[model samples]
Target chain A: MISLAGRDILHAWGKFVFTGVGLGLLIGVTLTMAGVYRGMVDDAKALLDNSGADLWVVQKDTLGPYAESSSIYDDVYRGILGMPGVERAANVTYLTMQVRRGESDVRAMVVGVVPGGPGEPGQPGYLVAGRRITRGHYEAVADIATGFQLGEQIQIRRNLYTVVGLTRRMVSSSGDPMVFIPLKDAQEAQFLKDNDAIVQQRRRTAENPAFNRPGVPGLLNAAIASQSANPYVNAVLVQIEPGYSPDDVAEPIRRWKRLQVYTREQMEKILVGKLIATSARQIGMFLVILAIVSAAIVAFIIYTLTLGKVREIAVLKLIGTRNRTIAFMILQQAVGLGVIGFVVGKISATFWAPIFPKYVLLEPGDAARGFVAVVVICVLASVLAIRAALKVDPAEAIGG
Target chain B: MLTKGIRINGLKKRYGKGETAVDALKGVDMQVAPGEVVGLIGPSGSGKSTLLKCLGAVIEPTAGQMTLGDEVIYDDGWKISDLRALRRDKIGFVFQAPYLIPFLDVTDNIALLPMLAGHPNNESRQRALELLKALDVAHRARAMPSHLSGGEQQRVAIARALINRPPVILADEPTAPLDSERALAVIRILNQMARQYETAVIVVTHDEKIVPTFRRIYHIRDGRTNEEAGEGRAFE
Candidate 1:
């Protein structure tokens, strides 16, 4: 038999296509919401990957550096480096703040790395342009996501640092691009007080009677010098020997150094599971609402279309068209609409993903699942229209 | 009862119960011979529509007997199982409005009945083409229902009614929407098709212009039918 649904759609192709396009845009938003959630998890993972460390050593009992505030002495890495199965260790500090470029400020995660050469645990893994931070101060490697150019001057705090190198995809767990500065500058940026506060502190220190004992004049200067500097770093990143497991090296650091240690797997859990759990839930709620809204729109459209054909349906029924055939026609139309909408949505999401403010990761597996979901939702949405069609009386076509 | 025609005896239909009951068709008797076109005429509120519905098997006669071409369709209740299949294979209907599926072209509209009866698509279309030629609508076979003129649409509906070659055709107000000349033309086509296919045709109508053409007419009033003879003049 000729397809009733196909012929009807062809008869009014413009209406069918325009309706499908509208539905497709809704499906696109749903898919894009799912992609945004995926991107958050990926950004967290990329942050860990670019750190180039097998283990992370943080202050005792702290979640640290990503999920919570953590502070340890900058000298802790030296002790960790001397441990067995340790190939290298480096001090890393993370401070998420606004940094000045020429006129406008850009939000980025300022990273403090020791001015050792490449292959150090905390330095950026690779640079896309220019060299790494080869100097002890005023040299920086900026992630390309910051829109920074090579050899541009950017101010971290009171000091101006030149962006000597540009890296790609090196972002913090929160998706802020990382600006790599030498450890000294970051330490000063993180902890230094303003000049007025420093002067007041110095006055307060000299007035204290314990330091004015008439024989220890050098003690006040030494104490004041100590107050001007910060010796704490956020975490110590460690690389292990070739044959060592992450857990094997991490246990010794926790035992001997008395600091909290996290292996690669545990750090991933901290970043993905704990750090972004609320945002993930928020996206999940949006996805659920979008699905329900999509189902409703489809149901309304199909119902209106079906209602308009009530007379034809009654005539078809009277002319010996089976109830199954009528139901199938309605179902086929709904699925056809869904197929059109899905294609439009996928194309729309693909074209617009890069322009979003945050990263949007669209995976193939998610798309497969989305296609199945659209079909199933369309089937379910057509049920109301099918029921209405089936309830039509064939006798109505032969009026009294 | 004729072997190739439709016969009904003491057909009854009552709506509701007790004081609110309505006896629409009470003990009505009618028959139409094969290759004969009979007119059922009555004023509004008479039992004409109820009788047509009963002959078409669209409504169950409360206490009656109905037989189509020697097949007993209703004794006290339904004698034939699957009333839907009975309607598809043994009965055809034409209505006041053509009511063709707007999406389908003229050929598919006529071919749909045979297709529903499990005929092959090509064979169904062949049958449809033969009827369309007989009804003088062959040139417009591929046109959609919306594009056809009213007379052309009525002709297509008649072709659709004959496509399955059922033993009986029940046409209710088939000329209600046409002018006097177009009404006579539709009746002529129905008569020609009935004679050609050796099928019984019963037309329920109030069109006074075509009333004198039937050899026999059943005039129904207040739940009963009175048989009478017509002038039997051919519209041609």
Candidate 2:
């Protein structure tokens, strides 16, 4: 038999198309929400991947430099390097702060890395432009997401550094673009106080007379000099040799060095499972609410559409149209609306993801799952309309 | 002898139970020979609608005997297994308004009954086309009900009723929405179609415009009917 639903839709195509477009926009928002959550997880994973480390050694009993605050003596990597099966070890510091360029500031993760060529642990592995930070103090490699251009000067704490190179997809677990500077500069930016605070500290020490009684002038100055410097790093990034497992290298650091060491798997758990777990749950709750709203809208639309055709339905019933045929008509229309909405939503998400300030990763697998969910939702949503249609009195066609 | 028409005897329908029981149809007896057109006229609150429902098999009667041709359709209880199929195969109906399926084109609207009865697509459509031609609505066969004029939609509705070649047709105020000229024209067409198809037709209406055209009529009031002969005035 001819498709009654198709014919009806064609008969009132203007209404159907307009309604479908409206529903499509809602679906688009739903899809975009899913993309945002996926982007957060991707940013966390990319942070780990770009670090190029097999293990992370941080302060004792701390989660990580990413998920939590960690502090370790900068020289601890020297002890880690002498261990067997250790390929390379480097000290890295992470400080998330506002970095200024000219008049404006951008929130970025400032990474302090030991001077090494590309492929070294704690260094940006690749560049989209310029070169790596070859200098010890003034040169920087900024992630492209920071909107930084080569040869541009940016302020990190009290010192100004020039952006020497650019990288892509290097972000913190919080989705801030990474700016790689030399270890010394990053440590100073992280721990150094202003000139006023330093002067105030010196005066406070000289006036105390604990070390200076006009007899120990040099002793107080020497004590103040040591306090002015920062010799601590946030974490040690370790690269294991081909035959050595990350657990093997990390176990000794945890045992002998008295520091916290995490394998790649453990760090990932910290970043994804703990660092951004609450955000993921929040997005999940939004998805559930959107799904319920979508289902309810579809049910209401289908039910109204069915009610509008009560007379025709009665006529069909009087003419011996089977209950299934009538039910199928309503079902097909609901699915048709969902399909229209899905296409609109997918297109909208793709077009707008880039405009979002944070990275928005839209995975193919997520889209596929989304499509199936929409179809299932449409099928379930059509139930209310189907029941109402089935209950229509065929005798209405005969009249009183 | 039993003919290829509709017959009814001692039909009764009661609503509710015990102290609140009300008999909508006390005892209804009616018949229409094949190729005959008859009128069923009644005032408001009468049992006309209830009897029509019973005759259309939309509702079961408390006690009744009804036959189409030689087949017993209802006797105390339903003799037919599927009343829906029985209605589709053996009965046709034309409402006060066209009540055409709004989603369907004129041709499909008429063809729907035959299609529902398991006839092949081409054959059912051909049957519908022939009826449209007979009803002088062949030119608008492809038009949607919304696109058609009021009179044209009524013609399509009539074609839909006759598409199954049913032995009995129940027309509930088929001309109630028409002007005097159109009302007489519709009655004339109904009479002509009945004689051509050898089908029995019963028109229920309170319209006075076409009342005189019927040679036989059944007037119903307060759950009862009284038979009467009309003037049988010819349509101008």
Candidate 3:
């Protein structure tokens, strides 16, 4: 037999298409929300991947240097390098701040790395443009997401640095782009006080009689010099030898060095499980709400359409159309609407994902799941309309 | 009792129970021979609709005997297990408004009945086309019901009713929406279709224009029926 549902849809295709478009937009927003959550998890993984470290050694009893503030002496890497199973160790510091470029400023994670070539643990892996930061001070390598070009001047605290290289996908766990500068410059930017504070400290030292009274002129100056310099870094990144596992190298630091050490897997758990857990929950709640709203819209639309055809349905019944046949027709129409909406939604989400401020990772697996969910929702939503249609008495077609 | 047409004896229907009980059909006895067209005329609330519903097998009779062709369909209770199949294969119905499935074209609307009864699509369509040609609606075979004029839609409805070639047909006010000319034309088509297909046709109508064209008439009132002979006016 000819498909009753198909013919009806063709007869009023304009109505069906317009309604599907409206529902498609809602589905698009839902898909984008899921992509946003995936993007956050991806950003966390990218941060770990670009760090190029087998282990992270930080201050004891802390979750950072990424999830919390961690401070260790800059000389700590020297002691870590001497430990067994350790191949190379580098001092690294991270401070999230707004760096100035001409007039506008962009938020980024300023990273301090020792001036070294590609093999260093904390250095950017590869450069897309220009060269690495070879100078000891006032030189920077930036992630391209920050929109910085090579040779551009960027102001960090009280000094200016020239952007010497650009990289891609180098972002902090919080999704802020990373800018690498020489270790000393990052130390000063993270720890140094203003010039006025420095002058005031020197004046106070000169007035102190215990140091300057007699025979201690050099001693007073030495005290002022030591007070003005910064020697602290955030964390030390360690790479283990080929034969040594991260656990083997990390255990020695934790046991004898009195420091906290995290292996790659442990650090990933900290970033993804603890750092972004709340955000994932929030997105999940939004998904549930959108699903309910979609089901409600489908049910209301199908019910109204069935009600409009009550007379035709009664006549079909009186003329010996099976109850299941009518029910199946309504169900098929609902699923057809869902299929149209899903295609439109998938395209809309793909088209607009890049324009979103944060990374929106739309996975093919997620799309497949979303399509199944939409079909199931449509089938469930069609039940109400089917029940109403089946209840219509065939005798109603006669003039009673 | 005749075996090749429609016959009923002491047909009855009741609603509710006890003092609140209402009888919609009381001892409705009627019959129409093969190839004959008859009219059933009545005022409002006179058991005409209830009798039609009973004849259409849409409702059960409290007490009655009904026979279509050689089969005993109802004797106090339903003798046939599947009334739906009985309605599909042994009876046809034409309604007041020519209520064709609006989404379907003229051909598919008429073809739907035979297709529902397990005929192949092409064969069902062929049968529908033959009936459409016989009813002089072949030109509008591809037109949707909404695109057809009133008379054309009625002719399509007539074709749908005759597609299954059932032994009996129940038409309820089949020409209610037509002008006098179209009303007479519908009655004339019904008579011609009934004789050509050798089917028994019972048209329930209050239309005065076509009442005299019937050779037999059954007037229903107060849940009962009275049989009489009509003027047998010619409509050529």
Among these predictions, the greatest DockQ belongs to: 3
B212 in model 1: Cα distance from truth in Å? 1.7
Q: In candidate 2 chain A, where is summed lDDT lowest over 10 consecutive residues?
A: A208-217
Clashing pairs in 2: A28-A345
Q: How many pairs of residues in model 3 come into backbone collision?
A: 0
True A-B contacts kept by model 3:
0.66
lDDT (tens digit, per residue) of candidate 3 on B1-236: 57678999999999899999999888989999998999999999999898999899999999989999999899999999988888888889999999999899999999998888889989999999999899998999999999999999999988898889999999999999999999989999989988889899999998998899999999999989999999877643
Q: Of the candidates numbered 1 and 3, which has the greater DockQ value?
A: 3
A1-400: candidate 1 lDDT, tens digit per residue: 7888999999998999999999999999999999999999999999999999999999999999789999999999999999989999999999999999889999999999988777899888888999988788999999999998988999888889999999999988878999999998999999978889999999998898776457876888888888888999999999999998988899889999999999889999998899999999999999999999999999999999999999999888887889998999999999999999999999999999999978899998988999999999999999999999999888788867
lDDT for every model? 0.91, 0.89, 0.91
Instruction: Give a tens-digit lDDT track for model 2, residues B108-140.
Output: 998887776678888989999999999898999
TM-score of each prediction:
0.97, 0.97, 0.96
Those runs of model 1 whose alpha carbons end farther than 4 Å from true positions after fitting are A210-214
Per-candidate clashes come to 0, 1, 0
DockQ of each: 0.71, 0.70, 0.76
Instruction: Report clash pairs, candidate 3.
Output: none
Name the lDDT of candidate 3. 0.91
